[model samples]
Target chain A: MDFQPTEERRMLADMIGKFIQNDYPMKARLTAGTSALGYCPEAYSKMAQLGLIGALFDEEVGGFGGSGFDIATVFTELGKGLVVEPLNDTAMTSGYILAHTDQLELVEQIILGQKRVALGLIENGADYDWSAPETLAHQTGSGWQLSGMKTCMKFAHGADALIVSAQTQSAPGISLFLIEAAAAGLSEHSFQTVDGGNACEITLHNTPAQLLGAEGAAYPLIDAAAARATLAVCAEALGVMERIKDMTIDYMRTRKQFGSVLGKFQALQHRVAQMLLEIEQAQSAVINAANDLQSPTDERNRAISAAKYSIGRIGCAVAEEAIQLHGGIGMTWEYDLGHFAKRLVMIDHEWGDQDFHLIRFSES
Target chain B: MDLNFTEADQAFRQEVIEFLNAELPADISRRVHADLHVSKEDTEFWHAVLHKRGWLTFNWPKSFGGVGWSPVQQFIFEEECAAAGAPRILPFGLKMLAPVLMAFGSKEQQEHWLPRMCDGTDWWCQGYSEPGSGSDLASLKTTAVKQGDHYVINGQKTWTTLGQHANMIFCLVRTNSECKPQAGISFILVDLATPGIEMRPIRTLDGGQEVNEVFFTDVRVPASNLVGEENKGWTYAKYLLAHERNGIANVGISGQKLARLKRLSLSQKRRGKPLADDPLFAARLARLEIELRNLETTNLRVLDEFSKGAGPGPESSMLKIIGSELEQNFDDLTRRALGRQAQAHMPEVFEPGYNGPQVAPQDMANQSAAYFNKRKVSIYGGSNEIQKNIITKMILGL
Candidate 1:
């Protein structure tokens, strides 16, 4: 039950942190977020070249054979950069799901940066039901056919393939299918997320799909993928928290109000101190959840729920407080503080909102 | 960095758990779970039980009649006790003053007082906070003028927790006026029954008489009662304060309260479902649990450092800050879980044989009382604001 990151993991985190700080600053994210694809494919290719996309899988599956902590390290750095990329959705979630299947060729393509995939888990009006899919899949004479709409398909425009969840007619159970973007009867309507990332409402009308695993066995796979996605979001939230703390401290030091720096005021100081404490708590939860990712079933589920619940609750509070403490400038789109807050709010509600995660955690 | 308990530690944990299950009286445990103030008889009964088990002075050295458990073992013992609803040991003697006495007192002082403290024969209260000198404790104005062979003490001490129940008090008194405020102070041990001393209970927001205001009008005390040098009381006071601040962390107590909150939340219904099923409340509870976990780990780290023979320094300030906030937050959540029930009861219900006001339910009669009582956590053992200042100066060098 060691919660501390390994020394190598720490080094990896530091390296990623430096890379994000030097290469993908807020301006870069702002520029990329406004792009047609919502993220820089060139930057993502660079990340793939650095072997960060396949951090949590085996070398045989075209990965670095790193543990969940390694992936968390990368995601946390990406979060600090407020990177408007689908690294979390594609690399962590879809990549993890692909690695577990027998599709080595597809996994290798994703690992080699030749192809990208985005997870389409949240269907329209789904409302936090990860297992109760609104989309339906039917086994056809040719292969499988998917028909429904998945809203908030993250980075959908950039992804060459989509790993989606649908209920099959035979078992009426949620299953996952990998569908190519150019398949017949596939359409995407792209829009901007609150954080300036590209999200799409993907409509599938008898879209040709390949079953990733055994029929109706993909629920657990999707669950694991969702857990991975949650931890990645938590890591990113922590990154934003760290930035807020640093920025708040910097503002306190320089921005004087009433003949003294705001940091000198006990009220503001206590508020910042509280923000640090919440971030630390969330950090512990994320590390614990990441460590439990491959552990026994019950413990893994408990840790994941606990992590998501803790992060969703504290992350949103910290983000909101960060904006409030920054005063009027924080509300403007021109300010980076609002950008981080927006990302935090979006990520907080992505896998499950605080309320949704809390119910799952308590029931578990 | 590992949180896993060793097999031996687990066995020790089981032993403690078993003892608590077998030995703790059901009524006492119920009172503890209910957050009701335990009777003096119940407190003494548990104290005797622990004393017989040779665990009364859990933090004392073996040579001083203690279990002499390792730091982790002590942590486990405290945690298990709190979790099992055991009454908290009065710490003015055992946890706070004993360490200072061990470090600075004469051998005779240790021999005369340590055994009594271990046997729970002497209940001690602290006389540090005065009307004007709480956060700035060294500025206390209580004076002890040296008379023939004794010091005549005069001045008042307010917010003396449990002082009305104490037979003795350890105090910080001004002995020399020329030196700095801290340098002019001397640590004095005074008998509460002294002729010129008077104690008046101060009713707190908590609706309990846990603290008192003690007035001294030329209370005479033998010069021998002085623990260390006459004008060096500030150093001893600081030492005592470090211990107080560390105990003020109260992670074990907070952890127990968190568990109780969970049970209450599970049983209580909100919006046609258990409060535990309410996503908002559940998220809040989970966040508290995570914070408590981090606090527990940080506390263990501090304990590990202490076991290496290093006393708590300014880092204890950090513990105080985090611990008090967490405790307050837990109480707030509990109150939130209690909902309107938290405000339904009057303070009089906590008194003996009240039965005057008809409350919502038997369980909720004390909810407001508990909430009011917990409000003092941030104010006592030095305010958390003071703790932050200490951290800022010590760690941040601001």
Candidate 2:
């Protein structure tokens, strides 16, 4: 069977690559990294103008009806720029939830860039376990009352709304609810993540929330969202890996010690080769996962878990090796190598760590 | 892109699986599964069985006594053989030399060796590396001086894998001294039993005499045994090496090893639970499995390119590098799973018939040995470092 990207997908990838090169340079990312939101709002608005945020949904949902390949293309570009935005969490995850639900109005708002949605699924003590949420929601007078703490909610301060997963009091399963950012009885404390983006601890005290979809039906949706988010992060990690590799290689070429370029040493060369190999492996997994998104249930779950496990492990390894290879410069924040490394480390732990996904994969 | 096999390909895969299930001996499969060294007789037996089915050269052209299966079918066959634990058919003849003969050998050369190679009449060994030549293979000093009708071959080839069991050796030797190093070389076929030829076994750390040091003290060989024109042997040798490196990728073998590792890990208890339950170990295993999957797909892509009439190129170098690393990684994981059992240093463990001391199962005992043995995979077949250079120059144009 063919594994090469389609001509259309290739064209999309090229376009995104060009966009990152021209619009979002490393300096721009560095500047944005110093901001409160850790990303350029103006640049993000431009991305929305290009229809990237809603790339994977149908036309009726105000999206391009683009395939997962399209989303991958956009994310790869975002990664190349080391763009510190909540697109991965907000657009990919929250947007996925909105697209799948019957709430066309909210989906339109997210698609048109009028409203931002951040995902708040991970609860206190729920160590990256997406399915087993500790947040609880009870039937209220009109709809639902949510009462739980969702920790490490990306971009909560920037979002207009939040998609929260909570256990239903009346049922034995988890349900997803959408609540306004300034809803009464909802309090948030935002802090900087390792990558310098905002992740919030949202405390919901009987917060008025509306069901995003049928109760207990959000598990599959959440799983799908998590998979998409993981793949998106992998695309970003691949970008960071490529950048780090290039920087390391360039440094070796110039940083000669013993009468020759450090790159000439076989030991260093093999290390770089190993890094490249891991990146390629991660790339293959991400692409395979993107393709598998269209497959049937069983295959999709297996492929996604396989992708997550591969990317998480390889991504972290590459980042660590990249830092090691760069010597002292890699550790300095001024050098920008630490930026990608920090982002990679954060992404590696997010959605699911390598071990978390590995267990899921083996069990599957 | 889709990974689904076509209906016809699926049927062909089923046929090959059935054949392997029916014809491959259970004891041989068991030995392979356990990573126990299979005897020469077992290899020859399976080769003969495949030869009888006209599938000995599974990837060769029908013109050369091969089954002439499509690339996908060949992949399926290999996947089946590996999954069924069929002993790996030694590739010196079928995979390495046969292709060289097909490409650069004279019609007479093809007529002489092709049939014999298929029928298990001649077991072949490589004579490329010398003590000095490893990754700098073109620096080889083995020489064959041409006289009137024959070449007087001298010098030595080290690390000749399975040379002790070989009846024939395809060698690279210096034929001209005045020219450049690579230019002066030639590819020649030699009878290992010829006069003045000697093979001394080199016992590896695994305590197995699988490799040999072959010496030629003025061994005479017919000049007609040269595969191609004199002084062009380097080209032919290079051609043969591309195939050798590709075969060394051994995706099917890696897949088989990974499956076996999974089973072994599941059987071993760690902290009152299977080793597979250990998240870190499971994660590493999963990561390796995923990498192996990617390698498998890339290999299939390479095979598809080959079926379209392309020869092995720099992409093959990528395969060799990744494949060898993945193999070594799998072995490392298997060793790690063995843990304390892996530290057992009884040299007698790998002997032909020596059962001594209370030990882990034979399989677990062999894990460390396998790991140590595989350390050379990245070093041999042109070290992964050299492969990166090839990729840098040929592919990335660095």
Candidate 3:
């Protein structure tokens, strides 16, 4: 079995990687993260023009690629630059959900950067329990009236619309609704997350929305979208962990403390070697998960959960050890390690923390 | 065999509490307790307060203007100050150099520098760790050549903690390269105002200018600045390092940080309950508490040895390794408790009256930075690796 990505995927990865490296410096990323719009619209448009967003979807949905490997490749570059954009929420999860419905045109707009959408599957206090949504939708004469709160809605502040998961009175299970940003009785409380990205706590007071997919049949779509998102973040974490490992090695080679470079210390050498082994193991997990994306329900879920769990544990270990090995220099805001470490550690909090995934792995 | 403090020791502890309550500046203590930044001015102000109360030199001999408190009394005072959030007494002047001078300095050196150190007239910084030096401090390349009545010094020193505020530095400079590396060293004190002496800040990972790099380009100092016989600096440096390692354990500060960590865990939620209520989190916290409890006992045993007229031996290295690791662990758990909220990097929020947007809660202001900065504890003061080597040599006789 081949482990390397296809030539087309490699070219796509190179293009996106170069774009991020050339345009998105740490200062620019920080500014974009802190901006009112949450992320750089120009950068998003540039990436869209480069066909980066379209690579996450099938050509039938006005895209060139739609596979777990495609999602992983694009996001790994995003993770390298610490890009604070809404690509995952928009082009990956929301796009997947929309593609499964009759709104194929909306998916096309998403891929072209003409529309930005964020998914609202996580409810307040319902940590990753997307199967039984607490947010309820009441049937109105014309559209639908959505009334509930959604938490951890990343980039929801800047989205053109939100795809929310809710239990409807007309359905026995979870359904999907598309709520416009300017919908009546909708409110968003925005804040900056720890990783220099934006998130919102959304409240809907009988907000006007329209049904997207079939009633009581959106759980499988939501589940699949979440799996793709999980795979993307796992790959992104690999990118971040690799950068941290490289930075640590460079530091050890250059930073002398005892008449010789720190790398000469056998104890520290072992720790760095441990970091390498952990990163390799995490890479293997991500690769397995990406390949297993099209597997049956139990297998796919188990593989994704295993990767997420490994990344959650291994990413933090690598990040923490890198900082420890770099000593005082690793923790500064002016330096790049602190930011990468934060991202690596915080990735676990999203897509379910390590403990959550451990249970998911055991049960699935 | 006794674990409880004597009534007299308890009385001394109460006296320390009363003094902290009366003399400690409320604003300084408030900032320290909240883990906010303590400015240089604030630190000097606290030193002045302690000096006025005749407590600044409490660890020194009574002949050197110290109170000559018991070892247990000293421990009580340190713990109380840490609990009250008092600024740490800068060790470069008061702790590291003073012990060396008291042991090896002539009467003139002691009379001049000791009083200045106590009155805050001369801020001191250690220049023992050069860029190429650190754990191998004896291999330092900074040199001082004898020139008539003056010695010309030329070399660079890095990791000079708080050298920006220091008017004086105690450095170990190479005197005679013809001999062994450890034997050719000499400990000499230099004034920051000396011509050709320069100090540049080395900003730490926490975005702090707490340490610096000092350069000496043919800086001239009086030959009398030398503390002991020429080429005998290595012995004095080793003595100073032993003294430094004893305090590096920082049992009191770690205890204070542990308290803060528990307080934070109580407020942070996980699985819709307080993180402290989570069984896994609670178990880790319990393990840490046990470790700290054992460390305190070990620290006291060492102090007890000191009381019985034995200097800190290689066992002190054990304390250093465990103490530093314990502190790093506490920092790790504290950051994890905040979850993603700890990732916010607002350095300005650490400044004492920063009215800007408080991104995270006041308690969570610098958890990530603290986690990053605490890494130095293991790397500096004879890195934990070096301490292990010392233990292997002296304790295990390996």
Candidate 4:
């Protein structure tokens, strides 16, 4: 019956917020995202030390704090920092799938910061049908052989292995296979994402791969895993959005125009208020989706999609209003405003964009 | 934040649904659910039913003869009522003025007015808007000059909704001509039966007499009728308007409309298929439903906070803007879904028991009326534009 965050969660929130405030500034984040390595190795190590990686899973999965609130709290703080790392894909998307499999060794390595994983699921022009994998896998004497082009392998250049999904000859649906990053038949073309994060185009030719879970049953797991990833993505976007609102409002208070602060204009003030209204609602949707993760499949699915859609929709609003409120300077690359705005747009495209989720939500 | 209702709250919700299902009249329910032009009798009948059940004054304090439900209970009551097609109890007397009287009226005023309002003796309409001072309400020039033991009033109030059926009117009058536009206003209550007062019905865009223009020519009222101090009317008027906007988030009503829209899109055909099967139309409907869901949650969050004893703020204006726009958007979609048939209906098409040629389906005959009448949703109750200004002042401190 309580609408307020618990004392424990509030403490966690304040600690994480301070960690980001004290350690990760916008400039450092920008440098890390646009770096040659595509991330700050030192900062990634710090996050592992802070138990940020371990916070995404439960005790049975070799970690603690796996409640929906934990995920929401962590991602929200990270969003405020605008930290560009591969934790979303590696530790969340691939991490969930790995936890469900009998890969105790790999899961422990991930929490201990000894190994990094990347999800190689999406292919060129694949629009969110997780089971519609075009990559093909065939049975071999030692292990299965995978051959396909996987687009947008998040943090692929940095990860030690890839959780690649491909269609198996014997399976009716797509199956997940774990392939080493340096497997003989693998090649990668790495680049930074639009929001200044790392991803790669991975091409595999008869790549040696090990099945993570039971063959032919990966689609449901993939669907559920994708739901979890989308939820994390939304929570992260909520963090980014609150920061944008804060910065925009602070700018309004100090930035003067025509003998008064820009916030003095009723028109601009109203627009900001409207932005707050939307983001508040978006936040509620995220919380609801987070809570509904363990509910029945149908209810959970609808809520996950609703959360994704609301965050995406509200992300654009926060972006537009923040930029407009900041006026011309908001769009500049050197300023953090433009970065937050761009990340909001990118968040919409991940998992399922607003349009995609809307159709899914309506049809379901 | 927990969205789970306690078991007791769940029980309360079920009780509300049961009450509404058993008591609401079927014919009036049909009109409300379809957004048809509801007669004054329909509203009165529903009002009396709620009153007899000791629920009509749920928003009032218990000591004042109200049900005195918590904000969550109030929300549940409203949600059930709107969902079950119950006519909205007019707020001019119960919701708006009653709160003002409770807060500022003298003991005699409370004893005299509160019981009558409970028993449905007085039907009230607001006298805030004029021809030139709709949004800029402080510029209102409805003069009420002080005289011997009374106040002499002379001015015109425009867009007085339901004034034709009202027995009393609450007005914001210009009491001091030589002071600030805002500071000089006074609030007065005048009996509609007084001489030199004229109420002319104004047929709105929907071709219904939903609003009126009330003119007062030297109408005198006892000084005791003033709610608070003279020249403090603007403050009271603002308070009442805030109350008006408070419940403007009509999420339950919009939920019903969205359901009806879904039903229509499923049964109605376009391009040789069900309208719901059309990709673009389906997308629009889905977006509307998502917005409605989000609005509902946000509303609950606000009501939850209010139940914790938080005062009403101008954030209500934000809710008003969202809720009104959704209703308007739904109306537009309903009409469009009816296709060419929606445009052919007039006022007579919705008259109860009119068995004319089927224009739009019998259930959806009010699409055109709903669309045209709902255009005023954003314009009245101090307009969405005024709401923005209030939000800016209250939140942004601009």
Q: Between 1 and 4, whose lDDT is larger?
A: 4
Which residue ranges in model 3 land beyond 4 Å of their true spot?
A: A20-43, A80-86, A98-106, A118-223, A247-266, A296-298, A326-339, B23-27, B245-247, B347-362
- Could you tell me which residue pairs clash in candidate 4? none
How much DockQ does model 3 earn? Answer: 0.35
Per-residue lDDT over B235-282 for candidate 4, one digit per residue giving the tens place of the 0 to 100 score: 887787676534579987888889888888878764356779868679
Residues A1-364 of candidate 2 have per-residue lDDT tens digits of 7877778667766866777778888778777765667678888787777677777566767787546677677777778778886677876678878878877787777766677898887653224566677778888678789888876677777789899998896777778999989898998765444365666667899899998888877888888777778777777777777787788889778765434676898888998998888888888888888888778767877787788788778876776566556543454445677677667655655776666677788887
True contacts kept of each: 0.01, 0.01, 0.30, 0.00
Ranking by lDDT: 3, 4, 1, 2
Give the per-residue lDDT digits (tens) of candidate 3, residues B270-304.
Answer: 65667788666788799999999998888888888
lDDT of 1 by residue, A150-185 (tens): 766778886889999988878756788999889998
For residues A1-364, write the lDDT of model 4, one tens digit per residue. Answer: 7778788778777877777788888888888877755788787777777788788888898887777778888888889888886677887678789989888788878876778889977763224445577899999998899999776566778788999899898968779999988998998866555566766778899999999898878988888888888888899999999989999989889875444776887877898899999999999999999898878778888999999989978896687567655643453455677777767756775776675687789989
Q: What is the C-alpha RMSD of each candidate to the true structure, in Å?
A: 18.8, 19.0, 3.7, 19.9
Considering DockQ, which of the candidate structures 1 and 4 is the better prediction for this target? Answer: 1
For lDDT, candidate 1 versus 3, the one ahead is: 3
lDDT tens digits, residues B39-154, model 2? Answer: 89999999999888878877887777667788778777878888898988888888888998899899999998998987778999999888656556787888999888999999
Model 4: lDDT to the true structure: 0.79
Query: What TM-score would each prediction reach against the true structure?
Result: 0.53, 0.54, 0.88, 0.54
Model 4 Cα interface RMS deviation (Å): 19.6
Off by over 4 Å in 2: A1-364, B244-248, B345-358
> For candidate 3, what is the DockQ-based docking class?
acceptable
What is model 1's DockQ versus the real complex?
A: 0.01
Q: What tens digits encode model 1's per-residue C-alpha lDDT throughout B1-398?
A: 67887898899999999999989987688678767877777888898999989888877878787787887888888888988889988888888889888989999999999889877779899999886566567778899999999999999998887887799999999999888787899999999999999999775533356778899999999999999898998888777767753345678888888888877776765545677987688888999999999998898888778878886688788888788779878865775565423333333444556654332234444654464455566667766667778788878999
